[model samples]
Target: MSGLSREKLLGMYQKMVEIRLFEEKVFELYGQNMVPGTIHLYAGEEAVAVGVCSALRKDDYITSTHRGHGHCIAKGADLNRTMAEILGKKDGYCKGKGGSMHIADFNIGMLGATAVVGAGLPIAVGAGLSAKLRKTDQIAVCFFGEGASNQGTFHESLNMSSAWKLPVIFICENNLYAMGTRQSRIMNVENVADRGTGYGIPGVVADGNDVLSVFRVTDEAVGKARNGEGPSLIECKTYRRRGHSRADPAKYRPKQEVEDWLLRDPIKRFKEHLIQEGTLKEAELLATEKETALRIEDAVKFAMESPYPTPEEALEDVYG
Candidate 1:
């Protein structure tokens, strides 16, 4: 895929598989009431996070949406910590405080995920400004849904980043539905990226179901931003295999739509591609799957065994 090294391609596959398994396990745990708080599963959209983060340097900043587990894993955050965080164990990245929607690891340049609809946009814009002021080649990326596009923060951040030529990439994971609302019912614009034209920045779309396609498009955007070309709007058309959040049921979605997206499952498609290209044997792919299952099991065990944060910790890390 795009002449990427065998290692990198396999790594991408592993990350996607890891996220899928992690989320699947989380889903099961939630059903069992083992996980606290509601969860927004990233099961269907693994390709977007893996593909884009693969193009990013470790030092580059990324702001995540409520559904951010995939982003954290793709950005090299410790899976054990992430899983622990989801389980609300003290061993978690946030000491069991952040839960599933707010996992953040600043060391990896993951600013954190906010459950608020469009809040991360301005934070990412600020990070981009910081990079520009520091005169570094580092860039900031903000991941949001099509629903957030309507927020004033989105427009304002894009305008500011464009005006200042800030090194930021605005990625819209247009998964068709914002919660239960389909994009067509909410926004008039057919393509979200087209809105970027008003800000005088490059607007592009990629196949979110294809990891390689996402990587190729994001690489171009990251390169442009690093070269001081300002912000870009990259819309990755995707679909979420699950409902908006836990217990959503998503009765509004049509059977055919769900079926169509199932056929485009990113992880399955990537595995098939790797085998067809002779890059990996079926056994090798199965081995990766087995390894991922074991890893997830270990993470779950670690989370289950870890203690919860002390009550006093609730008072820490708080602002008046």
Candidate 2:
């Protein structure tokens, strides 16, 4: 918060706002049956992804979850290509092959996102190994939900990452519920970050509602990784505004919880900060929203007009 320059800080705010709007657009299209498949939105938890990604270099890697749209956007993926992919068009990043969950641009060191639950863990550890063996200071980040943390792969991945001193960060977006099961029913520990100490690494919690808190904590962890300090586990306490997926209505979640988190919305907080700082004028914020709307409209047009990839291209990009 203190160290980040005004430009960088405002850029972070813009990215968060973009994610909120983009997810809203996706949800709208899904309701209208425009999107090809299901989507897991990041409407309420924008701060976690944006804050963590902001601390990373372009070369640093991040493995995403089913709710990966915000991650892609925060990491600087093109919205047009992303929207096209979700719409299953030829102009998509994966030529319409990969949809919302699997869309990725490895050129930006995203290393692809996984739709399978808890699958991105080992991949992240492997990326860390690759970086270590190559004598580079790069790090790989694995973003998963609380449900994933209970998986066997999660345990193995974290153990191996610590044992080998791999340059990786395990970020648990503990949104208080895994799909429909409440966190209290599943996780014994109130704080997931405390689990890191068991693996001989740093464990910390951040105010997932506050982007600044996320940015600061991740900056510390990432700086440590860059210095060969090995992997760390960070549990971001947040909530998902939308349901588990497009199909889920999130009836299991209590209304009180949702309302509580919504009161501390990341967008509102960032806007308040910007307003108080005098960097974000009322007109500027309104115009930004207008421009974002136009851009999303253009993305839809591009995707609709683009042709589906030919059958021959199906065999293409089959390998890693």
Candidate 3:
């Protein structure tokens, strides 16, 4: 909406800062042996999530990747419940069944994230098919990594979505690497967004570090989808500041590249933009940071106090 007013820009900055701080706290907690399982921290590429989700309606469905807590938060999922899910507490969104990879809030339209690379694409397409069949104007968005672009699921899902003209937005969070492999080495194509053209869909590439740019492009695509236009693909060129997963130290990547991306931190860029627009006052920004810290601290306490699921409930969600 007119390149984001001052208040709106401040809100965007706050969300990005919140995501960064949450991930930093998670990293510390995990090191202290407070959390379980492998974790994927979305520390740097926050603008992509905040920008895309801002243009979406509450009822619009979204599928997330392993590095998905940022997306979930951006889509309005409760921070306490998300922290609980990551901590594997019964009070979590999936009652500790989903863990970090599977945390979801159906009420917020986050249709669960998948640990398998590119698997969520088809799921989003299936959701899109249902929306199409039901004649609902809702769109489904899938957040996937650059590594997932090479999978068979990516190809099949895009083909199916193209044939059906489903209301789906395949958002490729091309952060330049797949876990540790370089995207340039794996992908010979000039651009990942161009893949949508082969599927007979529209493709748009936006600067992932620029919140306003991403918001503008996503708004256009999402609006088109809501108006019964087919699907569109958005390739967000972003980067992750930390290791891909908790187990990964990301040694394979060049040191210079890491330093380069760190310089382009999405949160910092958004903060600067807000400041330039006279949106976020220094005092107000500091207060918001304090609030975010308090919320995360309380979430940790809630997760710690919540009960773990009983052993008997393990076989419930599965079918023979």
Candidate 4:
């Protein structure tokens, strides 16, 4: 936080708290049968999203994975609209069609989130290419899990972006599990960022739970991209506090592993850092949490009162 202003640091803290509370609320809503379909919570990986998005401009683009609520929130999506989208209400970002995993706000440069693994890579590459062709300094960020790193799209997108020097940042959130399948069982590589070397781009890894570490690395990448240095691959080693989806209990993981990651919880660690640094006091942190909780409650109320899309509305946004 040395180079960062007090306001920026506190903003990051607020965004992290917002994401944690929002995910927790989603968990509760899903359990109460108020939400439809499935959900992939972003409870533990708050730092990666906040860190990366905080480095971006409002006009910069971003693509997200199934576990993407954190990305949307970090990109400045309205909580009421985001909640409505998850609730499948008419007031949602995608007009209630995208649900939890597909929310998009083009005005904010949030390209969208997709449930398809590794799919967002190509889309982000496309956005980067568009920006390059338009001669804009805007960059696109791709947020995917380590599992998606093994996909052919990952290799192809990185290769093309590197060849053309497109402004895109490929972030691999290596949570170590691809829907309960451990990373050790899938890829042979020790780090996803290491793959960037093969694609002829800078590969860097950061402590995903440490907000400041993530922000600094991403800020550097953003500067390079804006300077036409092309795309960089950032592998954030993080953990998911919950299962792969709402239906998953994540029993596949060992108890010791879960406990270890919990101790490194990003939000808790950041709060402590802010307090210790005297950048924020305990009372201020408490007040922020209380305000965030109230905002989340307001969002929930809005989503609950919103109407669902009519049956005929399904075919409206459809195209051949």
Candidate 5:
């Protein structure tokens, strides 16, 4: 809010709201048996997706993880299609097959999300390489969790991106826990950004809960990538407010820790910041919330009215 334009800040605020409300709807719908399959909610980490995507162009590509709804929305995917996808309706982006974990909207630059841990890393690297070869200024971003940093693909992709000076940014959303395992329990490094040094790329850290802070760092990285300066590792330190997946209860997390992070809720903080800065009034924030809720309600209605993919269509999109 300090250096950013009013429009930019407002856009970021709206996106954070959309993600939060969308995920909340998904959680509610899933509980009511309105949606099928498991979902990894992106409630608390809305700032990361909004901030990073704010730094990208329409043509730039992004790869997302299983917890990907935030990424899809921030990158300009249609809310209706995304919601329909989670509901497994025929109107979904993947025609109900990909469900919650594999929603992709290539028209909006989202390559796709993979459920397998760390699988998106190499895919993002490949997209970067293709962009470089095609002589396009388009850059690629990969969003992975702290847990994926330990995977072999992380090292391999980072090393390869640095060696070739590919236009890619490796973003690690370090929400403290990788699924049920805490970061400290599995990794020796204090910061995931430190892993960037091994690949000869600049490693940067930002507060994943702070949208402005994330935008600042990612804007710099995207600028460098556009200028052919190569890849950078950005580690966003944040916390997830829910369990790794639905029905898990997240009892593994400390009650105090959850309460502490909830106090730092990115959407609430951003709304307050907007009001304090006079960019948006308290009443306007409330109105926005109401509007967002209605929009998501419409999405749910649309998904409910839509049909499901027929059995014959199962192998239609499948490729060997």
Candidate 6:
């Protein structure tokens, strides 16, 4: 909200709402046995994706985690195609093969989402290196959870990117739990960003729930990366409202913790902020919500109406 134009602020709000609604709809469809496979919903962490992507250009690259619908939507992927992919329809981004865990739209610079925990780090590093080699200022963003931070790929990618001054931004969506295990139990450090010191890059932390806060930090990081300042480790302290995946009930988490995080729901908080600052009226916000919901519904309709891939189609895109 700080010095942002009215249009940008509204656009951010719309994106956050879109992500939230899309995830919620996916949850509903999955419950109805309409969606195939498991889904990692991005309900509570909408701000992180919208905020970071808002700071990036359309051509700027991003690699996402298994929980990546928010990332795809934020990066400007078409709603119909993304929904179709989740529904396993032929019109999907990956032609229905990738499903929920592996949607990619290169036109929007959404390189892809991989299920492997820390795999995106190296891929993002590769993208940054490509940009550097081509003498372009494009930067790459890698989105991973706290659990992946402990992976070898994390440290190795950071070290390599730092040494080469590749334009990369490593974003750690620390929602406190790596699946069911809490961050405190797995790692000694309180903040994941602290690890940046070891890699010789700036380490920063931001409120993942606060869209403006996230945008500010990411914007600054983007500036640094584009100016050839190398990579940065950004740890956004946030929480996932739902269980780890569709099968997880998240009983491992304390009931009180769930209640507290629900109270801090990113979408609700941003809505209140926008209203309090007079940036948007209540009716306008409601209208945006309604419009977004309708858009998501249309995407679902599109996906439902789409045909599934034929049996032999899977062998078409296969590679060694």
lDDT of each: 0.94, 0.88, 0.87, 0.95, 0.92, 0.95
**Pairs that clash in candidate 3:** none
Off by over 4 Å in 1: none
User: Model 4 off-target regions past 4 Å?
Assistant: none
Range of the 10 consecutive residues with the lowest summed lDDT in candidate 2? 1-10
Ranking by lDDT: 4, 6, 1, 5, 2, 3
The true-versus-predicted C-alpha distance at residue 135 of model 1, in Å, is 1.3
State the TM-score for model 6. 0.99
How many steric overlaps does candidate 6 have? 0
- Candidate 6 lDDT tens digits, 1-320: 38999899999999999999999899999999888899999999999999999999999999999999999999998999999999999999999999999999999999999999999999999999999999999999999999999999999999999999999999999999999899999899999999999989899999999999999999999999999988988999899989999889999999998999899999899999989999899899999999999999999999999999999998998899
Off by over 4 Å in 3: none
Clash tally, candidates in order: 0, 0, 0, 0, 0, 0
Query: Candidate 1 lDDT, tens digit per residue, 1-320?
Result: 46999999989999999999999999999999988989999999999999999999999999999999999999999988998999999999999999988999999999999999999999999999999999999999999999999999999999999999999999999999989998899899999999999899889999999999999999999999999988999999999989999889999999998999999999999999999999998899899999999999999999999999999999998799
lDDT of 1: 0.94
lDDT of 2 by residue, 85-171 (tens): 998888999999898988889988887777899999999999999999999999999899988988998889989999998999999
Better candidate by TM-score, 4 or 5: 4
RMSD of 3: 1.5
The alpha-carbon lDDT assigned to residue 213 of candidate 4 equals 95
Task: Count backbone clashes in candidate 1.
Answer: 0
- State how far residue 154 of model 1 sits from its true place (Å): 0.7
Model 6: residues with Cα > 4 Å off, grouped in runs = none
Which has the higher lDDT value, candidate number 3 or candidate number 6?
6
lDDT of 5 at 171: 96
- Look at candidate 1 and tell me the lDDT of residue 190: 91
lDDT of 3 by residue, 143-251 (tens): 9987898999998988898888898998889888887778888889857899888899888899998888889989998888888888889999998888888778889
